[model samples]
Target: MLSHTRKNKILEILKRHKQISTQELEKQLSVSGATIRNDLTQLEEKGLIKRIHGGAVLPERESKNSFRSFHKRSEKNVEEKKAIGKVAKNYIENGQTIILDASSTVLYLLPYLTQYEKLTVITNGIYTALELKNEEDFNVILLGGIVRPKSGSVEGLIGSCMLNDISANLMITSAHGFNVKNGLTDFNFYEVELKKKMVEKSDRLIAVLDHTKIGHTSAAQFASSSEIDLLITDSQINDKDLKEIKDSGIEIIIGK
Candidate 1:
């Protein structure tokens, strides 16, 4: 198998089993113990896991502000995220004010955003702003606030106040979790508050989510099911989940 793929599988195994020995991976992948040790060493350098005397273990759960967690999470569900981003790009028009949230899923929209010109894109994502800063045709507004390094988001009153006077034609967002009952929820309180404000200030709230976010719930609540204007997700989403979201009177756009 490819080295990166093998490493990712190693991570998965470590996460579930807590700790994995080099001999175990050698037996599983039909590789030598030395190869497994090399893989573990690489993962350690990436900070995805910790290497003990004879095995590797998934790192302890750190604060949500931890960069390691955010970076690892952002690398997951990448294909589905690209599909969601592709669908979201189709809705943007030239010169329209678009507000995008700081979620990693929404970050996929950056590469596909080349079509719009002279547009106003407002966001609280530090990474997102940096991605678009070189586009001369776009007016990029980076919301100034307390930076949450783990999530790569900017939050607090500074961001909220900047959003108050600005209304967007479209607001593209994502959440850590969603449920039919709780609606859109987030793990961070500051992010939840900012997302709610973005919804209220925009004409349409489009949620760009991967299939994994379905039927989940997080710590903070933002909007009810009815508040979202559109839900853009991957085609891999379950039929039952699609039906439930549509049943709530929201438009569902599954990426083709």
Candidate 2:
């Protein structure tokens, strides 16, 4: 088959299954593994798909309406987020002030915060604040702002003003989608504004993202890759993409 025809067929398969492995594509396309890999690479360059460990998945839709509610997002990539949370805890030292964004990925860090003897967490996530209410050793400061019901997050001028006065040792955040060019992007304008404030006031910024978000670009760009101190993602991230991100000078920690 012609290379263009083969690549088109591969895109059709990915559109149908959302994700397909190299081996499976090889079998279906009747092509060698190297050829399939090349096809995946070319498609990825076009921003059509994101290559994972052994497969490729469709890139996230670049629509603001594609944003899911907090509870709904929590259900997706559960294992990977859990693993990221475990590794994220290693960056925290006892009695340090930290900023946690309202992203579901940051919510996973709540359980791990118990390991610290004394820690203060400032966040805009209502659910996150409620969860930390029971931890005696931890001080949870829920930011005051307009509540975004969809994300269970607080944002607006109030939150931005509050953040201006607060300085944190670290900030843990997540994005709707991120890529080398856009860095970190989100669908909501208010959330993006608040995240910008958080990034500015924190000494270090750590972005916790799943593999699906790696090569995608969302509606609103917030923090650039250069602004982030580190990025924590699942092991499923493609080697080439990971190398490119690392080459950009951002530290990456793979969560097993």
Candidate 3:
């Protein structure tokens, strides 16, 4: 069986059972114990599953950190995310190429962006690409990679190589959390790795975050304060965090 197929099978079993022992996975998939363990490590690295002593289960907490919750992590703070997305749309216009990461907060910008007549959107978001489809004069390129079943977004860096030869007017995304020190962070290392590539290939980096995500930190840091050109967040962000944001010299747009 292909590695991806075998790995996916393991994930299916885990999802159905909620957790499964390495030995049982080997029995069901007819793969070696070593292979099953390696698969679990890969899934864990992507933040898809949590490994216990002898098995793996779904992540204990919601995926990712930022208002994206990783990808559309629920509607916990929907109104706040929409407000931030409105701020994000202000930076975009017609005839620009942009990279949009697959996050619920970033997802909110799609409706606002549909007003553009000529736009090229490059994204790792499966749902995002679908939303952009059928728009007049809009070209949507879905980054090629492994799709995380839960988030409906592509994972792994297989698709990021395309960005090396392409430059975008902007790259917009949300994070698991942020701090002046770590900058932007998320739970999955591979997602962060690809976001780093997008950051390098874009002219300006914009982080759209909700106030709740202002002070937190996640496992992996994708971009730092200096790399980000602007931050658009909700108004509830505290005075102290706002002060830190200003001190970092990154322009901020506080949404009403």
How close is every model to the real structure, measured as TM-score? 0.73, 0.74, 0.75
What order do candidates take by TM-score, descending?
3, 2, 1
- Tens-place lDDT per residue, model 2, 149-218, is 8779998778888887888999999897888888998755567778889889999999999998898885
Return the candidate ranking by lDDT, descending: 2, 3, 1
Candidate 3, 117-145: lDDT as tens digits: 78999999998999889786998999988
* lDDT at 181, model 2: 89
Instruction: Report the candidate with higher TM-score, 2 versus 3.
Output: 3
Best-performing candidate as measured by TM-score: 3
| Model 3 deviation from the true structure expressed as Cα RMSD, one decimal place | 5.3
Whole-model alpha-carbon lDDT for candidate 2 = 0.85
C-alpha root-mean-square deviation, each candidate: 12.4, 12.4, 5.3
Residue pairs in candidate 1 whose N, alpha carbon or C atoms collide under 3 angstroms = none
Candidate 2: segments with Cα more than 4 A from true spot: 1-65
lDDT for 63 (candidate 1): 23
Error of 1 at 105 (Å): 1.1
